[model samples]
Target: ESTGRPLVILDLALTRDVDETVRALPGVVHLDLPGVRDAVPDAEVRQVDAARAIIDAEADDFERTLAGRSMDSLITALRSHIGRVVMEEIERLRPLQSRLPASAVPSVDGRADARVVAGGGVIRANGSSGAIAVSVAAPETTSEAAAKVSSEAADEPVITLAQAERALHHLAARLLHQPTVMARRAGQEGREDAYRQALELVLGPDSVGGTHD
Candidate 1:
């Protein structure tokens, strides 16, 4: 009676019988053993569909999480590689800057930068943000000024901005070449753990996962 518009009563045993007058009530359904057996398959199908939908949703969420982790790991690795390259180059050039005459070293008031944007496009060595952006705050002379100094002061040891850019580019390229290729393959192959492990191994454990923006 409480089953909404139509009350359904299932009697799997034929021992107890339903009253004739009670069965006569409007919007009342009485199903015997045969009728109940006939409904089982349809009910089972509906339940199976619901369970499958839930499983699919959970699987999709898990996959997306793994993908996100892999991407984060890759970015962290790239940034770490870029930062190290920038620092090494800066240190290497510092001695040259100090030894040269003040006029030979042109001062610049900005940090060196590199970035990686969406789509994980080709890695850029320039100190700018793209698919991944890496900026380290170090006040230094511009590469262009250093280049001019090289030409004007031939006797002195000097490095230009172009050289620095190239150096950064080359170093980054070397470090990223294998990782980039493998990372893409990992994503395609659903090997997230392997990719993360590789990145951590190559870039250090600190590069496990990090956010740029």
Candidate 2:
């Protein structure tokens, strides 16, 4: 996508003094690039690099205080939040999975090895707004894996579990953005029945995405 530039992203999570945790984050964030960015090659990359330099300078602001909360509570909250995030995401994506062929999403090894995470993380899940802190434990290595995934995806699109889950969350936020719009004025029973049937098409048994199916 970048004519071969490896890009890195930063996500910021913070905790405040009070009930800020109860409010759910709204939809995605979008960045608009001027027409010149497309007209002039690499304009987007230049701008992004400058923006990243400013963020790197303020890295300390991204740190959080874990004072008062017990390690157990923090871990528990993390597990709970991650679980719900994944579960809701699966529900959201079941429909998409049903429509797309398995070949449409190749595994990491290029042989359907399912463990490969998505090749890109540009569109990612922002951690729960209410959570105190977000932590990740991973090997101190990524280059080898990144190179492999990138090479494979260049030939055919490859998807990872994390990528799939993130896509679901992204889709759910867009689909459910307007709850009021879901209200219908037609024959209520018939319309509602039709809606449920449509839902079943994507999520019902024997759906294409289901492993067993």
Candidate 3:
């Protein structure tokens, strides 16, 4: 079985070069050194080691060349050195899609239908057609949660069932943190009718603010 770790490769010469380049570019971090070395095989490690050795030798020769050079020469050399360092540390990771575990991925069917805004109540998936049935009650503490419960209770209510359903959908969009499938059933125009029917079934005719049974 695969360990699920991504394979990474580091090239010291490339890392140094990237490091220097990044200093000039700004806002970029070179990861060719530790990052890649920690993830790749021994062959790549040997190549990185060789590149570092070459860079050190080149630095010595360049220093000698600057012995009699002017300030401009020194600055140019400094810039090049920084750029080389930045690039040398750049590493890459190769990801294997087939190696990924299925359990690690999310399921598409686990989505909701609509959410109640007041209490974060969400209509159950596939329940929006016949009656507005919720998969779960709205959250008790959330403003939307509270609103949903209160709206259902208040006589001469300011919030209508249709409006509540819309609010639920909006709340779901905001906080349910899941995609909602709109319920489609015969004779149902929107979420309100569905919810009303669900409430009537659950709460009965004597229940306050429920649809007539």
Candidate 4:
């Protein structure tokens, strides 16, 4: 009574074992052998169906989560690949900056930083450190740039950057499509080990985010 929990009594004896007054008590349930036996099958069927539904839902959620993680890891690896390519290309261009035609190079006050403005953003490559920095334009700046682009000729650097970004994005999607498909198939087939092994072989052992559960 203090705990406010219901009390359940199962009387299996052939004769009356519990006092008749017990059934009248608050929060008390008294079940005789015949009553208990008769309710078992229907109660069990209901419970089993509920349990199966929950398990199926959980399994579907787990598969989706796993597939999302696989895609995320692949995207991370792709970004790293793009960064490496950018760094290498920037380094290669460092020596040829002076020899490059004036029409090819964007005007800058200093040779130490090369900046490209495209699609309402700026990408800067540091000549000395070989580091890259990217920044998105503010809303006002983007609007002004858009107005300027409409009124005047679009900058060559902007066009080039947009083209490069589009090409890279397309290539990355194509490159990663197969791996993503394989990951989904592996998760559905319960062959997660094969997914990890194939990714390790392709992206290297250190590339696949973290250990699996």
Candidate 5:
């Protein structure tokens, strides 16, 4: 429910364009101006209260929808929404090509960047700083081979075995966020099944169903 009263200061700003269009209509009240506040009577205060209640209820619904959802899920949802909005804006601005200079258009390269996968127990240099480290363990044999190879690799900064282990932990945390680690935590069959169910609910079926024990 909406009370026709602005529930937030930002709402007032958003209504400015709509208010201009309303003012253009023949018999519409010109409540767009700041002076219009002076005309609000004591009875109109009820409208503000109604609007506040509506806004609060909407906020509650938003909180509930986001509850227990991972940060990644929230980020993905927001990015998807923003991508749609950006596409719409680009389409809207397409007709104004003449007004917008050719130079004003932003340039973009459509190439897909290569993704480097980190396997566990494989030592490699940090891409950003060229610091040596290991990926999370891939397989037992592969991990052992990687550790041995890393140990023999010359001219690399010497990170001790203990330091390398710590780096693996950090790398794991970086690549797999808390929700994934929590879902994989060791437990008996019943508890593990419960965790799997909870994970399916949170991360969706694709994340939980495809993995084999």
Candidate 6:
């Protein structure tokens, strides 16, 4: 989460308008960078990529340097900076993160992440859990049943994004198993009886009876 460069510590010794400079660069905030620390009012640029080279070299000088008095005289290591960065990113992702697939959905412990799918009309993601379990009785030749379901769902009230996601998962699973079930039952001896049984498997006795003419 702390993958982005959040801190922008300006060298008051070499640059002026630290805040303005930071604002010029996208996503650069003075909040991450501590108060400025400078040895000289302004140091002229002697070469190119000097800052990059120093960062690449990874040589630390804080141990050797003692406390100083300047507008940039802040200490105690920028420990909280990284944390602040991560929190900011998490906040950015919270809104749509729940809609993401289970693989990409991270376990957001504190925030209002969809960590669990509550039963019935509610939706949630089981805290860091695998795919949601869906069941269907749309046996042998689900084309008619699936088509009917789709048609009816189209007329229903607008569902929340979470509900739509759950519906998608269920529809995908139902379609996947449709062929397998049809193949197994295709070779059955009785034609009319088999068709009736399959229809019953799909809609159950109550549904079939309710639809009778």
Would you list the C-alpha lDDT of every candidate in the order shown? Answer: 0.55, 0.39, 0.38, 0.59, 0.44, 0.37
Would you give me the overall lDDT of model 4? 0.59
Clashes of each: 14, 1, 43, 0, 7, 9
lDDT of 6 at 169: 47
Off by over 4 Å in 5: 1-47, 58-122, 126-154, 178-213
Instruction: Pick out the ten consecutive residues of candidate 4 with the lowest summed lDDT.
Output: 151-160
Question: What is the Å distance of residue 192 in model 3 from its true position?
Answer: 93
User: TM-score of every model?
Assistant: 0.36, 0.22, 0.17, 0.38, 0.27, 0.22
lDDT of 6 by residue, 117-191 (tens): 211122333434433443333232334433433443333222334443444445445553553344234423223
Residue-by-residue lDDT tens digits, candidate 3, 1-213: 545554333346743654345534434334566665587999887998999999999997676444323223222333344344334322110121112233222223333332232234333333335244444442355444444444542321122234434544454344322111111221123343454345346534332232223
Candidate number of the best lDDT: 4
Q: State the lDDT of candidate 5 residue by residue for 1-213, as single tens digits.
A: 656664322224434745455555544455443546666886797899899999999997666444433233433433344445445644442343323233322222231111111222334454456465335544444344444444444333333333434554454445455544443232312245566566557556555443334
lDDT of 2 at 31: 22
TM-score head-to-head 2 vs 4, winner: 4
Question: Model 2 off-target regions past 4 Å?
Answer: 1-71, 102-156, 160-213
Model 1's TM-score against the true structure: 0.36
Tell me which residue pairs clash in candidate 5. 119-136, 120-136, 120-137, 121-136, 121-137, 123-134, 124-133
TM-score computed on alpha carbons, candidate 2 = 0.22
Where does model 4 exceed 4 Å of error? 1-51, 60-79, 86-99, 104-159, 184-213
